[model samples]
Target: MLQSYETLRQTGIATVRAQIRSGGYASHTAGLGRNLLQANLAIIPQEFALDFMRFCQRNPKPCPLIGASDTGNPILFTLGQDIDIRTDVPAYNIYRNGQLVQSVTEIGDLWTDDLVAFALGCSFTFEHALIEAGFELWHIANNVTVPMYRSSLETVPAGPFRGPTVVSMRMIPEERVEEAVAISARFPLAHGSPVHVGDPAAIGISDLSAPDWGDSVPQPAGHTPVFWACGVTPQAVIQQAALPLLITHKPGHMLITDVPDTAEIPIITNKNMPR
Candidate 1:
């Protein structure tokens, strides 16, 4: 079983698809690939795709656009050669009128001809970079989900999509805060850089122990909770928008793509241009 775990960790897109097809693995995709990109999934009607795309463009810090599928197609060739948006993710959340209606292992029955799939860069990609740069992550070490909060900062509105920016918090030792920032700053697509360094209440979070999503890990002595813009922001915005129908990967159960984690850097060359 340990070898099977290791095999899944090292497996590529094809192998993962096979496993997901066989119902052998149905959990969060975290820690599965050492250097592969995992993505946040958002599926919406084709009628709303353009507006959502603009929303993402306007709010790139929280909604970085990584890969988008063609209209009415579940295959995201740009993200991976054989990617199937419907079943690629480990788990999915089905929402109707902005309320979560069900959690499913796959969306084959829910898929429709008018649906459009989106693949957004996730901060998990940068977590690997942080670890590679010698920064320790508390959640990975403690085996807990990274805590996420809805920040006081508001995202720029585009169409009907507007809401508070949602951020994921990580506890970093005092000495390594700079290293964490420097490493994460290199991946803007994956919500690069720290939005807040200390004091959870500064960002509208009343208590660090309580998070809107994910399990909270205890902050150790001499460490501060560092926050970063998260891909979950879009889900929050969609909830607020009260869209008639929406679908997303369940929190932590991300879509693993064939895209190499090192394929893109987060640095912005044109500051004036939308990210």
Candidate 2:
């Protein structure tokens, strides 16, 4: 059976997708894709697509839209030639009426032709940039998932989608904070720079040792927990909407896309985005 991220590290995107499709690797995808851009998956019906897209528009920091699919289509032509929303991800979370129903490795049976998949920009590339610049990510080094928290920061609501902005924390040393910001700023789709720095209490995060999602990471001696607007924010917001059906990538198990981190994607902002 296929195993760890390391085992699939050398494989290409197609191979990795195939591995996940086989249900042989349902694991956290923190450091696997190298320089490849990763995306958070949100599959909803066409009936909710317009509102959801507007939600992503009003709240770009957490719900940065990168790629999207048409109604009744599983293929995100921009992300990959053969990307399928139903089985490309390592794991999926099913929600009904704003409550989690179950987690599945694949959504083949739950998929409907009316579903539209949205691929939002994720921070894997930003984390990669940090590592390339000599900043160490504790979760990546320790082989655990990054710590994520549901912050007190409210998102700009669009229709039924409204929730606190979720953030992922990385412990950065005192001196490297500026350097981290500069590197991350280049990737606007990666949620821009650090949303919050130092003192988790300011953001209403009560505990550094306890995260709302993913594994808890220790706060090293001189390092401070720097929070970034996570792509998981949309999933959190969608859950509260209590839609009849909502499907999302299991937290930390993102969909690895073929797009390179350095690729110059179109500057898409503002609510006037073309459908």
Candidate 3:
């Protein structure tokens, strides 16, 4: 039998991935594997790999490419020795011709020889930092996914990948906003700092209650809504490109990597990457 969510939280990173692979857990990965590096995943055809890489390069803040699997490879040796892109993520969002068609726990049947997998830095990597620094993350405290929105900020275009940037929001206590910013700024691979600090409307997000992705959290008194550049930007770009097929980690459902959040992973890696 699968362990309960609370019990699983006390387990190791590999155990969490094992549970996810076995269909024992298929939910958001926010607080799981705490302080361990987590990644946003995007798997597409090898033909578009170069352009996609360029897109990530052009928009490092929103699309910090942590690692990319070798063409047609399902195993991400750099991220984790046994991290199989096909079934490691908790859940996957299937995009067909740029439209999200389905959500599944695993994509083993859809894995193909022509596919290329890319792992981008995710904001969840910094949540532990904040919590350790004594900041209360409303979403996590309430057992909900952080609220994410489609912002008016445009990303640098690269080939067919061009779209508005996506931003994740967290309600930070007003006085400690600066401290929160300073702490998060250290993790460049994990979306270093706050892109917008105040009003949601200034960035084209009109409603705090309705986010484009993830669950919304209530704004507590004396807290301000802070926004950060998110890795999910690729999904928006993929939608605009109208690609024939694309697979991505379902919003907030990430690939839990063996790498510690403190480690800085290069944009690309080979078999030599340290475990």
Give the TM-score of each candidate: 0.91, 0.93, 0.96
Q: Looking at model 1, which ten-residue stretch has the lowest summed lDDT?
A: 266-275
Question: How would you order the candidates by TM-score, starting with the best?
Answer: 3, 2, 1
Tens digits of lDDT, candidate 2, 106-208 = 8888878899999998888788888888887888888778889999999998988998999999988988888888898888777888899998999999997
Better of 1 and 3 by TM-score: 3
Clashes of 2: 2
Candidate 3 lDDT at 99 equals 88
On residues 1-275, what C-alpha lDDT tens digit does candidate 1 reach at each position? 12354467677667766777556777656667667777888898888888899999898878878888778788777776566788778778989999999998888898889999988888988998887777777777655578888999899888888989999998889988898888888887788888889987888989888899988888899998899998899999988888889999888878877667777732223332222
Error of 1 at 144 (Å): 2.9
Off by over 4 Å in 3: 266-275
What's the lDDT for all of these models? Answer: 0.81, 0.85, 0.89
Q: What 10-residue stretch in candidate 3 is worst by lDDT?
A: 266-275
Prediction 1 TM-score vs. true: 0.91
Best-fitting candidate, measured by TM-score?
3
